[model samples]
Target: MSTCKNCQNQLTPDSDYCNKCGARVIRNRLTFGNLFTHFSEEFLNYDNKLLQTFIALFAKPEAVIRSYISGTRKKYVNVISYFAIAITIAGIQLFILQRFFPEAMSMDSISTEATKEFNLKILEFIQDYQSIAMMLNVPIYALVSKLVFIGEKKFKYNYTEHLVIYMYLLAQLSAIGTVIIVTAAAFDLSLGTTSLILSPIQFIYIGYALKRIFNLDWTNFIMRTLIFICALIAFTVIASIVTGVLMYFNGDFQKMIEAQKAANEAARTVKDTIN
Candidate 1:
């Protein structure tokens, strides 16, 4: 009797596969040549899949999401793995900026005391918790998506499906955002001004992606896109306020405000003496 190497199942000499485990009956031994060849093949295959995913994500995000939902698995990385890796890359970028590009962003130059305090508190909160903040966005995106994009058949994406879509979308966006941050730091660009300049690009990318995903015509597309944008703005404002309030009660925000106010008063006293 011949045996299957994979499961050690008894088989006829003529059998091409193991009956018990459905394993392919391979004849080749584990040679160094085969090991190298297999390693290269797997590595290249993974690299290719990653590239295809990013291309589809940037060039036609809706199509990639749709394809994944339709059971196509080979062309892209799984959403969970993609999101984890993307967030880690983003965290690296944030660390680099915070450590090496300290002067890239500062509210210290602003004159208004309240504005300075509020902005500094917010900035510190964001800097400290940006990774967690972005991760928190996944569920919010899924929620908003299900709310805004409800329809039948081709237009309908269920909540879990929408979660998958958002995971991929957010991963790609996080990578893009990290790149934008690095570029701004390199050029000594104002993050506020850069955000303003990039807002339309963000809207356009999202609008086109959603339009394709929803299969909407121009009028409905514009209406739905605007509504989604408004929803996002509202959600962001609420989240920011909640974060600020929590930090305030914890005494973190109070410390920032007091420090800023003391600095401002000292500056005022110095100016008065000079006058």
Candidate 2:
């Protein structure tokens, strides 16, 4: 027999709650069975439901959200869980693709002296401020959504709702990006005309998806689309500038390599003539 500390009620050894006051009772012994029971209670008890929700998320995102928001949440994946799984999958895909496809990992592949320098500098910057890239998507989406929805009454969504949209958008983009990366890796293809042309179209899809998800009207939807396009342009400009700065340094390196090659060729020519 045990007693509750708060209510002073008599409790059985196996009892978790006080009969009198309903306060929780703590067990003194921490055995393997008790640990397993606690673990089971927290995470493992809902394994089947979690798996079911995950499947629904990939199959029908809108339906999953609709179900969850309408109080049918038990049968679907929670928004946080969906976001976590999507982000984890995206991260893993990026890692694998980058490892296997060096060209795909690069922003540009012209391989000019300037481009080489820029690439090295960008790599160094990524290594130094890795966390910045991880946090960029949320803030970028938030800004775009806020700007697009400004002064609009019917199209307005709260921050949390916007966050859900952002997650969905991220998941879609990550899936597309993964497919592109994997294909490039398998075929050893360059980021040529196909990528350049399709990339803008992908943003169009994102804008359309956002409009549908938020139930925005055509005017508001167009504004959101423009915001996305602007954001893309801004990102491109920043990347180009960074690459240019790095290329300046790379030019010196390229000169040394060129000079070494020329010297070796001249030496070989002299030896051949003497022989």
Candidate 3:
């Protein structure tokens, strides 16, 4: 037994605080090393949690997100915070690649001018609305997942609960996508090849995530995964239709296509003049 340093109350030697007065008892002297030690301990768990977050997020996302939604969130990052951080990371990846690797993004890497133009349009759309597009997909994804898994006998996660899963999934994808882009840039990989490599990684991540989350048998897992993917495709089609309608009514879609055509024609004319 020992005495409290602040209140002189009796306490155990290992006690961190005085029980009587509730004063801290294990304080260390303030110095550069101690300051950094304390700062790092609080900084990592309370605020700067991306590293520990990705550890669970990539390795066992279902478990982590489930724990979070279940209200035990001391160890896992908040879902919305993770999603926002992931978006920022993806944006940074685009910024770095655009600023540093111009040749990798040039039309020379693609097979044809038409393909290049298509990719350019897609990229432009993504750059303009990727964040909003991704956010909107979350609820649509949750709805699809719920409908697909509505027949599960063992466990049935509710619609709201599925949002937790989808949010974590998107966060993981954004983080992994950022890494993929950075790697592709480093290796001078073309966008087509990058997508080819990334698609499988994305599928595998979600596959294992579902596997762990639902504890499904192989047959059910395969069935659910396929349906989930199809649901995502359906959601994409619906979103595209909605986007097209909005653009059409506002004259943006036609203007965008016309602008693209004009640019392509101008490039051809310049090439012909040079030749």
Candidate 4:
């Protein structure tokens, strides 16, 4: 009898695959070439689930989301794993930018010194804890989506389902956004400009995905999309108010004012020298 290395299943000597586990019978020791071949088969093959999932997300999102939600998971990468991959990619992109294109991360050329300081502080926090920030956004997005789609009786997805929905949506966006941001950075684009370019596409793709998932008519889709945008705007306003209050209490506003005065003094000195 031969043994399957993967599952310890008994096998006939002539069998090429394990009957129980379906792993291919490997008769040779592990080597670099074989490892590369295995990786190509798993991730780069034509039938690989990751590639299928990525293409299907844009081609037929409803089928992918519905199948996973209905417990048919083998055909596509699950939400958690896909999201983790996206977050990892995003982290790598941040590292590349900070390492090779540090100036792209700054906003000083486009803003006053005080504004630049505030923006840099925000940027630093985001860069330092981006994964946490992304994880936090998922739940908030799920809540907003659930509230918006509460009236759908036929496809009544619960809060957790909404979480799954946004997880997939955000992961896809992150993947695409990572590529765009990296390419833009290579060409010396500012992070702010790249974000401005991406934000609309992100919103449009989210609306497109939701429309397909719900099979909504154009009118209903537009209405719901606008409502979603308004809800997000309200949330942003509230968060900004709270953040401003916190900044004031922490004396950040005083620092900003001082920075602004120093910047003004420097600008006036330069002007006098020019005169």
TM-score of 4: 0.90
How do all the candidates rank in terms of TM-score, highest first? 4, 1, 3, 2
lDDT over C-alpha atoms for residue 254 of model 4: 82
Error of 1 at 56 (Å): 0.7
Over the stretch 22-116, how does candidate 2's per-residue lDDT look in tens digits?
88787658899888987777457756655555455455556655555556777755666655665666566656656776565554554454355
lDDT, candidate 1, residue 145? 74
- Predict model 4's lDDT versus the native: 0.90
Best by lDDT: 4
Q: List ranges where model 2 is wrong by over 4 Å.
A: 1-72, 98-104, 110-116, 123-132, 191-198, 217-220, 231-275
- Per-residue CA lDDT of model 4 for 14-115, tens digit only, reads 999998999999998999999999999999997999999999999999988999999999999999999999999999999999999887886654566557
Best candidate (score: TM-score): 4
Model 3: per-residue Cα lDDT at residue 32 = 95
| Local distance difference test scores for all models | 0.78, 0.63, 0.78, 0.90
Query: In candidate 2, what residue range of length 10 has the lowest lDDT sum?
Result: 109-118
Per-residue C-alpha lDDT of model 1 across residues 56-98, encoded as one tens digit per residue: 8888787789888998877787787788889898879868877
Model 2 residue 272 distance off true place after TM-score fit, in angstroms: 22
lDDT by residue (tens digit), candidate 3, 8-121: 899986888888999878657779997787778855554556667788777777668778878988777788888887788777877887788755554345436444544565
